[model samples]
Target: MELRPWALLLSLLLLPSLALAAGKCERLVITGSPDAPPLLWRDPQDPTHLIGATADVLQQVAKDLGVKIDLLYGGTRSLALDEVRSGRMDILADAPLNLGELDNLDYIHPALVQTDYLVWTRKDSTLAYATAGDLQGLKGAVSERARLTPAFDTFATQHLNLQRLPTLTPVFQKLLLGEVDYVLAGRYSGMALAQTLGMSNDLIAHDTPIDQPGLYLAISHNSACNDPWLRGQLAKKMTELAGSGVAQAALQRNLERWKAQLQQPVGTQTK
Candidate 1:
C-alpha cells in the first residue's frame, strides 16, 4: 500500500511533464516576405529578420502559447514558401491559402487577417474603377510574388493587361510615370509605401478591393514541430486575436512604424 501511494504520486508528477513535452514545442522558426509592410517587412537594422503586424501577431501568439519564435527573412516570398515547404523552416508567418500549398502545409483556420488588395493609380488619373472588369485591357502591374485571388488571377490572365513586377515600389513608380495604368497592391501596405516614398499625394488606392485574401499562419508538414496540439493551440489563439482586434491594431501601429523608419536618413534600407 505504501509503495502504491508513492507510485501514484510519481505518476501524477510525470504525466504533466510528459504531456507538456508531447504537446508543446519549445521553439518554432518562421519566415515571410521582406517587402510586405504593415503585414511584414525586413527589419532595417537586422536584414535577417522580419517585422510588422503579422510578425507582432505571431509573437503575441507565441507569448500566449509559451513558445519562442524566430521570424527570419528567407529571401523572396517564393523562396520563403520554398523554405517552409522544404521543412527547413517550421512556420510561415504570413501565408495565403492556395490549393497547391495544401499538400505541403497545414494552414491555421479563421485566418490571421484578410488583406485587401486595391487598384492603385495616380491621383490625377481618370480611372473609373468599380470592378475587375473595369480594368480590362488597362495596363496594370503587381508583384510577381503576389497572390491576389484565384478568380482574379484567372481573369487577369485571360482579360487584363497585367505585368508582373519584382516589387511594389517599382510598380507604383511605373504608375506615377504612366508606364502602367494602375497597380494592384495591399491597402495598408500600399499606403505605407506611398507615404514612405513621399508619393502619397500622387497615388491613390481604390475603395473597392480587387481581392481580399485571408492571410494565414501555416506550418510545414515536414517540421518537427508539426503536431495536432500546436496547430490547435495556434488556431485557438488566432480566433481569439482576430475577434479582439489585436491584428488590426497591430496593422495600424506598424503602418506608422514603417513610415517612421523610412523617414530616418540612414533607415532608407530595405531587403
Candidate 2:
C-alpha cells in the first residue's frame, strides 16, 4: 500500500481549521435585576451567583439549545437594560416592554410570564379608595426609575404626592413603617418580598390591578447570534422546553411553594 503525500498534507492542514471552526461560541450573558426575587436574584451564599425563576427557566432553555449561560448581576432595572442595549449582555429575562423599545432587539412571542401592578397598604390602614386617582390626596410610593405603563404614568402625573423609591424593598419598608400611605408594586414580586420579609400579614395587596404586562426575553440587537436563523432556532428550542412541561411544572412548583410560604404564620422567618 502507498500513502499519498498530497492527501496527508491536506488532512494535516485542514484538521486544525476544522477544530477552530467547531469551537464553542462564547457563553451567553444573561443580565437581570438582583433584587427581583423569584424572577432574578443573586444567590445569598454566593453573591456572585444569580438564581431565580427566570434563571431556572433560562437554564432549561440553554440546556435544550446546548449552550452555556453566564449569569450577570445588574442590581437595578436600568443597569440590566443598559447591559443588553450596549451589547454587553446577550439577553434580559422577565423585562417589561415599557423599559424600552425592541425595534432593534428581538423578542420571543408568548412571553414566559405576565406581571401586574398593584397597590399595597397596611392591613388596618384607613386608606379606602379605588383607582389611581384615589391616591391624589395621599402620599404614595413607587419605584423611582421605573417606567410605569401608560395608564399608570398618566395617573401619576395627575397626582403630586407620589414618592418614588429606587427599589421595592425600601418601598415595602416605607409602607410597613407608615412612611407612605400606599406602595405600588408588581404583584408577584411584592408577594414574594412580603413572604420573605414576613410582612404578608401586616400588609395587604388591593384587589384592583393597575396594569398587566407580558415579561419577555430581550435579545441584544448587536449580538453576533442575532439573526433570523438564530432567532428561529432559539424560538424552536424555547417551544420545545415549554412543550416538555418542564418549565411549566417548575413554575407551578415555585408558585405553590411561594403561596404556601405566604399562607404560613407571619412570624415564620426565612433567610
Candidate 3:
C-alpha cells in the first residue's frame, strides 16, 4: 500500500517534464518574399519552396541547432507576414524589424544581413541624388509591398511624390519608360533584376544608400518553438554568422547563381 503512494508521487513528478518535452519542436516552418532575389526567391523548379542567401543561412542555423526547417514560398511579402502572424508558419527567414509586428513575433538579435536600399535611375537622367530630400519634386516608383526604414517611409509619405505598383518588374518598366524619375530598391536585388530584364545598361544605382536595413529571422510568438532556449540559440548562431562573413559570401554565390540560371535556355533553368 505504501508503494502505491510512492508510485503515484513519482508519476506526478514526471508529468510536467513530459509535457515540456512534448512541447519542444523538432522542426520549424518558415516563409518569406518570393521576389527578393540574392536574399531569397521562389525556387522555380519547386514553387513551394524559397532559395537564396537567407535560405542558406537558415539551413546552416537549422543544422547547428539540430532541427529541420522548411523555407516555403507563402505568396507575397504581405501574405507571408500573414502566415507567421496567424501561426500557420513558425518563422520568417528574412524580415526587416517592424514595430507593428512586435506583437506577433520575436525578432532574433544580430540580423542575418544588412542591405543598402539604393535609388535607381536611368543612365541619361540628370537627377542629382544626394539625399532623400532631393527626391521631393520628382516622381518615384516602388513596389506597393516594399518596406523601408521607418524614418524614410514616413519622409517619403509626407514629402515625396511616389507611385506604388503591384510588383517590381512593372515598377522598373515604368522607370525605363520615363514615367517615374527614379525607383527605390535593394542594391543586390536591383542589380540582379536589371540583369534579368536586360536593363543593366539603361538603369544605374546611385552610389549613396538611401536606407540600410538589417534583415532578421523572426519567430512567431505563437510558435511551439518560440521558447527561450530556441530564441537564445538562434540569436547566438546569427551572431556567429554575421561575424564569420558567410552570409556575404552566400549572397555573392547566389547572385551568380541567379545570373547563371538566366543564361540557361528558357524552360530548362527553372531552379
Best lDDT goes to which candidate? 3
- Model 2 spans > 4 angstroms off: 1-27, 74-76, 98-104, 126-130, 133-136, 145-147, 233-271
Candidate that beats the other on TM-score, 2 or 3, i.e. the better one: 3
Candidate 1: where are CA atoms >4 Å away? 1-24, 267-271
Q: Cα lDDT for residue 257, model 2?
A: 59
Error of 3 at 96 (Å): 2.6
Superior candidate under TM-score, 1 versus 3? 3
Question: TM-score, each model?
Answer: 0.86, 0.71, 0.89
Task: For candidate 2, write residues 148-175 as lDDT tens digits.
Answer: 6666677677764888777778989999
Residue-wise C-alpha lDDT for candidate 3, range 148-236, written one tens digit per residue: 77888888899989898987899999999999999998888888989999999999899899988888889999887888889999999
- Model 3: how large is the Cα RMSD against the reference? 3.0
Over the full model, what C-alpha lDDT does candidate 1 score relative to the true structure? 0.88
Highest TM-score scorer: 3
Native-to-model Cα distance after best TM-score fit, residue 253 in candidate 3, in Å: 1.1
Give lDDT tens digits, candidate 1, residues 43-73: 8878899999998988888998899999999
Q: Rank the candidates by TM-score, best first.
A: 3, 1, 2
